[model samples]
Each structure stands twice: as C-alpha cells, then as structure tokens.
Target: MTNDAPLVPRRVLLRTAAVLGAAVTTRLLTAGPAAAPGGPAPSAGPPSAAGPSAATPVRPDHRLRPLAGHAAAEGRRRLPTPVRTRPVLRMPGAGHPMVLTFDDGPDPRYTPPILDLLRRHHVRATFFVCGEMAEHQGGLLRRMVDEGHVIGNHSWSHPLLTRASTAVVRAELERTSEAVERAVGQHPQWMRAPYGAWNRRVFRLGAELGMDAFAWTVDSLDWTEPGTRTIIDRVLNGAGPGVIVLAHDAGGDRSQTVTALRTYLPRLLADGHRFTVPVRGEV
Candidate 1:
C-alpha cells in the first residue's frame, strides 16, 4: 500500500531536527578548535616560586576539546598555510635620498608625461609594473630602462597580498619579473607588494627570488583622483630626506599624479632634495 502524508506534529519535529542539524554542522565547521578525541583539559600553570597550593580542580569541557593527532592533522590540511615575508630594503645613507615609485602600470597615457618630467629634472625613479600591463606596453618599460629608471616587479595582476599561497605569490611576482626582464633585458632587483600588504612569505619569496621588498613612507594616494593642486600639496608638504613617495601611473586616470610630479620634481630639485634609488650594499 502507498504511504500517506506524515502527521502535522511529526512533520514539524522532523523539520526542526533538520534545521538544527544544519545549524550544528555549520557551527562545527566554523567554530572554535577542531574536534578531537577527548574534551579540552585545563591548562597547566607554571610552578609557584614558594610551593603548590591545594586549589580545587576544574573539570574539562568536552565541547572545547583539543584536536587529536589525526583530527588535528586533518584540520591543519584545511587551514591556510602561513606565508613568510620578504626582507624589505632599508633607506640608504643619512643624507637626503628619496625614492619615487609609481605602481600599477607603465601606461602610455600618464607614464610618458611622468617620465618626461623625471628626464627634465635629470632624476631617476622606480617603476613597479604589472606583468600583463608591461607585456602589452613594452615600449614604456624599455624607455624606463633606457632612460636609467629602475624597473621593479609589482606582480602580474597586482594582487593585494604577496603572501598568498607560494605558487600564486611566486607566479604573481615571477611573471612580472619575467616580463620586466624581457622588456628591460635585466631581472628586477626590487618588488613592492600591492596595497603594501606584506607578510613573511612575501619577504622570503621575494628575497629567495633575488628581489628586495620596498614599502613607501609617503603615499600619494593619487588613485583616489584627488585634485592636481592637492596632489602637489601633499608631496610638497611630505617631502623629506630618505622618504619614499608612492604614486600610481595606471589603474585609472592619473592625470593629477602626472601633473603633481611635474610641479614637485622641479621644486624638490630646487629645494636641494636629490631624488635617488638605493644602491646595492648601501643600506
């Protein structure tokens, strides 16, 4: 015989059980420590200098149990691996030496103007290029090298963190390094993590790959498209000896950044602040 529909009370109970089961599963998956063989034990205290006291013992909580060998291993397998950071380049010499770095491109639109200003000022700056962009705009990259400007790897896609999984992080940096090498005919000696997100893996991987990690002390934040006058004001106000000013050449219209550079480069030069790069074995 065919079975009839379930009774109302029984149906409600089954639905509630299913919902509770799902909630429990989700909590367990996203919850505290991983499940183990036994409940969590009270942490042992350090030895007392005088002597041990007769204190009441606290019972372990089964729900807060520490993971066992197999379970802990499995839990670890699902967790993200810790990423080691690359060693950062320290500022060279006590004398006034500032570095100017442009990121996210080698855009023909803005880069040429910026390059022209640098050339006019007879100063060299660093260009951190994305692999894909650089591959497509090899001419700009070539000009940068030929003009004595330093080219640094900013990663292939300009990822926010260079501490992603080893493969992904390496690919991000290596692809750009290869692109820069192809265009400039030399491997980059420096790298800057996108968004300045650095970690141990970023440090170790960059160093292992023979690139020094560089972070900016003065961020122009030109990506926000601030007015040209405001951009110039920020740079002029923040200019100091050994300060690294961060700017963008691409990722959007960077007219303000380009214009600001034109205004400040000459002014900074007049102010006796020499724009320069860190030399090997200097800092």
Candidate 2:
C-alpha cells in the first residue's frame, strides 16, 4: 500500500466498476453513426407494411432453447439466398405489427430492466447483440430466449462494416453468430450491421451465414442521449404497421431508452400495433 493510500475494499472497487459499466459501453457507440446511412435524422413516419415476402410458417424453435454443447462451426450453417442490396426496412405482414429492436447490448445493468419491462408487458422484441458483450453475459442471452425474445447478431465489435476488410467484416459477423449459438443453442437468424452501414459483402456474408439484414424505419436517436420525452415522441410519431423502431439497451445511459420503452410500448399496443421479429422469408 502507498503512503498516501486511502483504504478501499476490493468488493467496493468491484461494485463501483460495475456501476460505471454502462458509461464505459458508450465508447462503442461512437464507432459509427448511431443510425448509419449518415445524414440528417429523418422525420418520423409510420412504417408501411408492403413488400414481397415468402410465406414460411414461424419456426417452432423460435422460443428460447436449453443450452447444450457449443460447437460454433457445426452450430452455424451456410445458407444460399438471393443477394440482398439493402436491409429490410419494415415487416411485411398483417395485424399491423411493428418491430422493436435493441442494439449493442445485453448489458448486465440496463438489459435486465428493459427485459423486465418487456416481460411485464408480455411483449416480444428483438435484440441485436454484440459478440464481445454476449460472451461475458450469456445468461442475459439465455434469459432473452427464455422470455421469448429474438436475438440477432450485431457483430463482435461495433465497426463500420463498409470500411473494414472483407476478412475483418466476416469475422465480425460470424463471431457474433457463433457466440449467440453457443449461448442459446441456435445462431441468430437476424443480423444487423453496425451503424446501419451495408455493402455487397455484408449482404452476401449475412445470407451465407443463414441470416437476414434488418434496418430500422424509425431512429429513436436514443444513442444520442436525447431526452426521455424526445425518444418517446420519436417512437410515437413514427408508429405504423410493419415499422422497425431502433433503440439501444447498452452503449451508454440507456436509462432513457428503457423508460421510453415503458411509455411508448403500451401506447402503441393500445393503438393496435403488435411487436414482432423479422423473419428471413422476406430477404
């Protein structure tokens, strides 16, 4: 101990470190534009439900599965599909369904509260998780499944996919898929590129990994640390059928996002908007 050292317990240091983890996660957000497709934020609009999609019945295993032996390579399968040039902007189905997607998370502190809210409301949403975070918090991933939430790949580390090398990009996507597989007994079928950036390589690699690309229709701008009311306004104003609302559970001060979810979710539900996950048939 140093002469000037003030006594502090190891347990206290650990607890303090844990409390500040959410702020630490914020650095990852600056890796790229929060919504990608960099430009002025678009005016909020209700998502329209009109697009060509295949009619595949929902998979029975869509719910959470028991954790088993994890073999990343065997767990992942190569899928061949028509090349996609862009991300799926909205869902194409009936019942006026709107999708809720949280990116860059599964944080120990923030994710649990968000998950609790979703559970209380009896709603199912999608989480686009990072591999780096997922590996450390596999239990959160398992809880997501157990609660009937969808897990999608958000890459290993948040990076601009278009700027990275082909090999680098592949690793980012594949590693996240594998980590998720190792956690939930199934790889994520839905994959979202960080910063909403997309390219030929991204689309090709995603399909090959048996994944589909999902982008948001409404940018909550929650990543900006916008006020709680602003986040709610964005979602409420943008409410429409088949629309995908983008928010984050990790990556800095998601308390606002969490609160906004509780506020807007029920209002949207009362307005006859159903929350659903994206299926690959559309891709």
Candidate 3:
C-alpha cells in the first residue's frame, strides 16, 4: 500500500491549463480536417489505438482537456530572464550531448539491466521514478543515486493530468519527491508530466517545489512497443545536441526498450555523442 495524500498545489491547476493551451493551439494550426473526427479517409499502417480509426470511438477524454485561456495569464507571470544562463530550448554544449530519460520505472525486471548497460557505457541518464514503484524498490533508488544517475519525480499513481484535481497532482509529486529523498537522501530537482501533459498549474507547482519542468524533445514512443528496430530508428534519426529523449524502463514489458538501448548506446557513444544529465542552474 502507498501513502494517500493530496499531490498537487492550487497553482499547478492554472499552469497546467496554460501548457495545454499551447499544445492545443499547435495541433489546431498544423492539423487538417482529414485528421479531425469523422472527416478522414483511411491511411496506411496498423489501426491506431489512440489514433483515428472508424472501428473505435475516438472521443477525447474531457478530463484531459487543458483549461481555457490560461496561457496568456501564465505568459504574464513568466520567470525573469537570468544572466549567463543556458538557453531553455537549445541543446547542451558537451559534444553532441543528449539526455536519455526513463519514466515510471525502477522495475526489478528491467531497471537493473538498464542501469548495468548505462554503467558499461560510462553514461549517465535520468530516471523519473514513480513513488509507488520506488517505495517498494528502495534499493534501486539508492543505486541510481550512488551510481551518479539523476532521479526525478514521475508522480505516484501515474494518472492522466486532466482527470486529477490540483490537490491530487500536488500529492503525486510531493509524495514521490519525499520517497526519492528518503531513499536517496536528496530531493528531485526535475519532473516530467505523465503523457507529456503539462499546464500552468503543473509548471508552477513544480517550480515552486524547486524543480525544473522537463519535457522530451524526441519521444521514442517505446510505450507502443514498436519493434526494437523501429525504436532504434526513431532515436538515431532524432539524435542531436541538447535533445531530451524519452523512453520507459517500466509500465509494461520493456524487452524491446532494453534491446534497443543495447544497440543505440554504443553507437551513439562511438559517434561522439556524450550522454549527460541536466546541470543545476542550467534550466
């Protein structure tokens, strides 16, 4: 059993709304009527479980919708520009650097091997660990810190943000941060919203808690379990300086993720790309 507590703060609700607005705006600008509901002809590839498929009803989850008009308000409250700071959207400056981040993990079945492979390659990556998962696997959490890997908060139960109340989000983050601190003796400095979902509230609360909000630049989409080759292709094609690549160590059978890493890590290293973590005062 896990500790039951309210996770998110009041500010997070507003912040989450803002981030969602940006995402929805981008989608509307780029998407066509064919991509809209009941307006499209069939395209190639497997029927998408999350995509438009006539066989399945594709109702958007109302709970996941971003709060309206929150973006403008957040824009007014943006953080002050700092001197001598790294650009928020630029890549890191450490020789074709890229960040590899794993979410919802510390699984005994998968995490150990992932950690071992990282060790073998002399690389460091970030693990956004679920509190529930880490609480039960404290040793893994300890190992992550001991081995110089960065651990981040990935919420407790991994609920979709649109469905959770502000309080719920705060609880998810705080409890997970507490768990990481207890196990590793230091609090997390970073967090990634579940499902790439972000809003004003999520960003505000994370910043208030002294964490930098991180989103991926390249999504391996490993969660879909595309074959190992597909996963490798996505990462290699997307590789670049300062790119944050998202993958998962748990949340399902991750055999393909494990296999793909074995192929790409060595290749990336040989290609002169150095794996790194986000430095403090950099984000």
Candidate 4:
C-alpha cells in the first residue's frame, strides 16, 4: 500500500503557493499567441488502450505546487491500501520497465518538439494533460492519439483536488476527461492528481470514474529548470524496475527536459530498458 503521509512537506507547500499560481496563470495568458486565430480543433480519433496491467505507476515532487494543509492531511488519511490500490509510490512486480510521463502539457511550442523526439526514438509514453491545455491545443492531443501515445487526465486547470469540494473535483476531472474524449474519441481511464495531493475522496472519485490512481516513482525535477545533465542524472541514477519518471511538457521552459530526454532516453533503451504506459483494463 502507498504511504498515507503527505507527499510534499507542509512548509514547502506553504512557501510555493504564490509562485505556482503565477506560473499557471502566466502559462495560459502567454502560451503562444491565441492559437493562430481560427486554426481549428481536430476531430476525434480512436483512443489507444495499449494493454492491461496489474500494477500501476505514479509520481509527485517537491517542485510541484503546494497542496492545502487540511486537504493534504485528509488526502494522506484516505490513501488506498498497498495491495489493492494502484499508487502509493511504486508499481510492484512490474520489472525493470520504466514509464515516462509528461504533465500540464500540449503546449504547441514545446510539446510538438517533444513529440518529434519521442517519434524519432519510437518510444511510447503517457501524457497526463490538464483540461485547459488540451482545450487550447486539441490538435496536440489529437496528434498524441494519432501517434499512439497514452493520454491520462490531470484535471481541469491543475487545481489541488483535496482542497476542493466533491462536485468541484468531479468537474475538474470530468471536464478534462470530456475534453480528451472530444479530441481522441474516448475518456481517459487513468488520472494523476496535480501535485500528487490525492485524498480518499480522489481515489473514490477516480475509481468511480474508471481510473486507477498513479504517482511517479521518480521525479526528474526538470520543472525547476535544473540543468540538462542534472535532469538526466536524476532519471538515470534513480531508474530501476517499474519506475515512473515524472516530467512536464508545459509547466515551464522544458528545453532541459527535451535535451535530457534526447540524451537519456536512447541511453536507457540501449541499456536494455523498455518503456511502457499503464493501459486501462483488468486492474
């Protein structure tokens, strides 16, 4: 079972609130010149299931925004038990396989290039997208589906779910799910709470919505604009069986993430490691 303790320290959460909110606002307000006027949202396409698995993966990090204190406590109290719940920290028995995931994305500038790199390497990854982002860049979502990447719901606007009411939480998840469904023809079956601040309510809601909770086993800390080598080393030094490496495509300048991926992705593959996304079914 995943630990019931808070994923982020109380002090850290308190300290970073203003900064995170600003970043989110700045990202939306200045993401890239209003999508070129009437560029058009893409039509729906078939969504990918990939395959089923008994184990699931998830991630959280100090670099993410804070979770409200009371909410954080409640969330920790509600975490699912180790054997049956999908995420606590790691995916048990899934082997030296690694899952690479990007959150808060579909940013046209960075995501497209990141997608190109993944395509070049023929690597499949999961993208945990925020609804606002997908709504703004549906084409990117469509391209993700078209290219055989897994899309998971990250929430409507990247709010801390534990702090919101049940209705708000549902709306956050459902709205995003609907947006992704519109883009890719099916709702996502997996979810990762923003900042990994999941509470019992989140788990229940996610299960009700047919999702298995997942958190990353490893965080690259790339959002901090850490050097490329640092990010690469964080992923490489920490990687092991059933590890999920957390990264972001849109939270900020992800050039370091892009470069780090270019350096470490192939290296991981060359070192006899395989990448996989958690599929919906049988878990």
Q: Indicate which candidate wins on TM-score.
A: 2
Judge candidate 3 at residue 42 and give its lDDT. 21
Angstrom error of the Cα, residue 125, model 3: value is 0.2
- On TM-score, the stronger of 2 and 4 is 2
Judged by TM-score relative to the true structure, which candidate is superior, 2 or 3?
Answer: 2
Give the alpha carbon lDDT tens digit for every residue of 135-164 in model 3. Answer: 656566666754556787878767666467
Q: What is the lDDT of residue 109 in candidate 1?
A: 65
List candidate 4 segments past 4 Å from native.
Answer: 1-88, 94-96
Stretches of candidate 3 off by over 4 Å are: 1-96
lDDT of 4: 0.66
TM per candidate: 0.68, 0.74, 0.68, 0.71
Candidate that would win on lDDT? 2
TM-score of 1: 0.68
| Evaluation by lDDT, superior candidate among 1 and 4 | 4
TM-score of 3: 0.68
C-alpha displacement of 221 in model 4, angstroms? 0.9
Question: What is the alpha-carbon lDDT for the whole of candidate 2?
Answer: 0.69
lDDT tens per residue, model 2, 1-283: 0111112332243234334553444443346444122121221222221111223332223322211222122235644556678778877765446779998877777888998887776666789987877766666776676565778898887777889998999899989887787666678877888778889999988888878788888889886777999999999999987788889887666789989988998898677666655545553
lDDT values for all models:
0.62, 0.69, 0.64, 0.66
